[model samples]
Target: MIRPMRLVSIEQILQARKLLEGVTRKTPMEHASDLRSLHGGPVYLKCENLQRTGSFKIRGAYTRIHGLSEEERARGVVAASAGNHAQGVALASSLLGAKSTVFMPERAPLPKLAATKGYGADVHLHGAVLEETLAEAIAFGERTGAVFIHPFDHEDIIAGQGTVGLEILEQVPDVETILVATGGGGLVGGVAAAVKATRPGVRVVGVQAQDAAAYPASLAAGKPIRLKEMHTMADGIAVGEPGKVSYAHVADLVDEVVTVTEESLSRAVLLCLERRKLVVEPAGAAVVAALMQHPGAFTPPIVAILSGGNVDPLLLLQIIQRGMTDGGRYLKLRLRVPDRPGSLVAVLSRVSSMGVNVIDVEHSRISGALAIGEVDISLALETRGPEHCEEVARALQAAGYTVV
Candidate 1:
C-alpha cells in the first residue's frame, strides 16, 4: 500500500505562519449582514479573493518554495494549474530566484495564462485538460531533475494552506461552521487538518461543484475515485479526482462534503457582485452557494471562504448578463406587427407607459415569419424586476400584437 503523506502537523501550520509572515496577506473576515440574517447565523466571509495573486494559493506556493533545499531550488521547479495556482507558483518561484515551468491546459483562460507568463515563468500550453497538463509537468520534472511542486498533495503545500485555517480561527473565534470550496481538496484538506487538530469543535465542510462531486463519491467508495468527465461552470472546483494526499486528510478530518449546482453558483457570484460589491469567480462562490441552499446548517457564526477572483473578463461579462436576465432585469421578446410607421411607435408607447426602459428595438423584415404585409420585431428591454417584466409583457399583449 502506498501510504499517503501524513506529515502535516498543527505545529507545521503554525510554523508556516512565521514563514509566510509578510508574504501572504492576512485576508479579511468580512461580516455579511444580509447573508447572516437570511441564514439566521453570523456569516463571515474569508475574502481570499483579495489575497496575494488574487487567491490563497500564494500561501502554499510561497511556503513550499521557501522551504526548498538550496540544491533543489537551484535545480528549478515545475507545477501545473488552471490559473490561480499557476500565478502563485510563478510569483513564488520568481521571488526565490528559481526557474519555473508552469504547464497549463490549452483551453485554460487566456487572462490567467498571460498573467502566469507575465510573472516570469516559462508557460507551456499542453493537453486539452488539466489532468493531462499535470501529467506532462510530472514527466518534464522527472526528465530534467526539476523539483515537482504538487499544488495540494504535498505536505508543505498542505501546511502552507493550513495557515488560512489558522487565520480564520483567530479572526472568527466563535465560528461554528467553515465552508470551503474543494477541487483537489488541497485548501479544505489543509484547513480541515488545522481546524480539527486545534479547534475540534468547529465543523469544516467542503463544497464541490455538483458537476465535479468526486470527493463525495470517493467517500462513499471509501477511497479516491476518478471521474470519467467533469462539467461545471465553476471550473476552479472541477477536479475529477481527489489528491491521494489530500484525500486521506479530508476523509479523516473533514466533517462533511456537500455539492452545489451551477445555478446556485452563478447566483452566488452575482450576489457577491451586486450586493457585496465584490468580484468572485464561480469556484470561489461555491461556498456561498452551498450556504444559500443549505440554510440553518450552521448555528451562530458561519464562515465561507471566498477562495479566488481570477475570472476571465469575458466570462464575467457573460455571467453578469445571465444573472441580470435571471433577475428579470433584461428581457427579450419577439412580436409580430403590421408593416407600418405607427406599429413601432404604438409598441414603444405601450412599453414607455409601463415605465419599462427600452434598451433596444429591432424590426427584422428579413428573418422572422412575416405575413404578407406584417413584419416581426424583436424588442430587448430592461425592466425594474419580475413584476415590472410582467407588466411590460401584459402591456405589449394588449396592443394587438402577437407576442411570443
Candidate 2:
C-alpha cells in the first residue's frame, strides 16, 4: 500500500520564501506575444529558465539544505539527477557550507556534468539511467551517514518550489490559469498548493511530455504508478514515477494534468528561441507545447512556467532541425532521373525555378529500384512553409520528374 503523505501548506511556503530571500531569484514573467496570438489571449512565460543555476531547482535545494541541522550539515548531502537538480544541490550545499556528492547517469549531458562539478560537487558517473543513479546516491548516503537530498519528494522542497507560485500571483494579479512543466510533480504540486490557497478559483495545470508522462495513469489510480519504459527529448521532465508528497499535493490542488507530443515540444523550443530570444530546454518548453497543441483549451491570461534552460548544444541543433521538419519548412525527397550528364542539373534547375533552396543533394546510380539508365537523386530542400513544401512536390511532379 502507498504511504499517506501530508500536503504542504501556504504558511510553509511563505516560511520557505523568507528563508530563500536573497538565495533564489524571482524569475521574470515575460509576455509571449506569439503564443498570445495563437490563443487569442494574454500569454506569459514564467522564466525560471533564467533563474540562478539555469533552473528553479535551486529554490527547493537551498531551502532543503538550509533547514538541515548543523550536525546534519556536517554529515554532508548526496543527490542524483540528470542535470538541473545536480547543479541545484551542488550550489545549495556549497552555499550552506555542506559537502555535496552527486551521482549522475553515465550518459548525462556533458554540460550538466561540467556544471554540477563546477558548482563544487564531487560528481560520480553511475548507472545507465536515473533510477540506477538514484539508488547509488541513496546507498552512498546510507553508508556514509550523509543526508540524501531528494530531487522533489520532501515537504520542505515542495514548499520552496511553491514560492514561484506566490511570485506569479504578485506578477500577474489577474491571472486566470497557470501551466507548469512537471516531472516527479514537485514544481506543479508546489505551485498548485500556493495558487489554490490564495486564489481558489484560479486554475493550475501540469504539463508533461506525452512519452514519459506518469501522472495521468497514477492520478487515475489514486496512487503513484511507476512506468515500465520512458523515452523523450525532454529528459528534465522524464520522470518515471510521481513522488508520494508531490502526488498528494497534485491530487488535491491541480485542476488538470496534460501531455504534449514530441513534435509540439520541438516547435515550442524553436519558437522560443526564434521569437522570444530565449534558450529553453525541451522540458522547459512543455507548457508552451501544450499551448500550441491545444490552442483554445487554456483560459485567458495564462502563465506557462519555463522550468529550465540546460539543454546540450548538439541536442538543440537536432531539436531545431526536427521542429523545422515538423513545421513543413524542410522537405526531403528522392527522385528517379535518367543517368545522363545533365539530369542532376535539370533537377536543380527545376527546384531553383520554384524558389526552393536545396540544403543537400545526393546522386547515385546503384539503387536496387533504379533501372540501368536511371539514377536516384535525393534532395533536401528548404521551403517557406507547409504550403510551399506541397507546392514544391507538385511542381516537381508537374515537371515530369518521378518523385520517389
Q: List the global CA lDDT of all models.
A: 0.89, 0.95
Return the TM-score for each candidate structure.
0.92, 0.95
Q: Write the per-residue lDDT of candidate 2 for residues 34-93, one digit (tens) a residue.
A: 888777899999999999999999999999999999999999999999999999999999
Per residue, candidate 1 scores C-alpha lDDT tens digits across 1-404 of 33655657999999998998888889998888889866786899999999988888989998899999999999999999999999999999999899999999999999999999998899999999889999999999999999999888878889999999998989998888999999988899899988888789999999998888999889888888999999988888888988888899888889999998887887788889988888999999999898887887766688899999999999998887776777678889989888888988888887788877888888878854576788888889988878888887887788677889
Which candidate comes out best when scored by TM-score?
Answer: 2
State residue 245's C-alpha deviation in candidate 2, in Å: 0.7
Q: Which runs of model 2 end up more than 4 angstroms from their true locations?
A: 1-4, 367-374
Model 1 regions more than 4 Å off: 1-7, 336-340, 364-375, 398-402
What lDDT is obtained when candidate 2 is compared to the true structure? 0.95
Error of 2 at 309 (Å): 0.4
Which residue pairs of candidate 2 clash? none
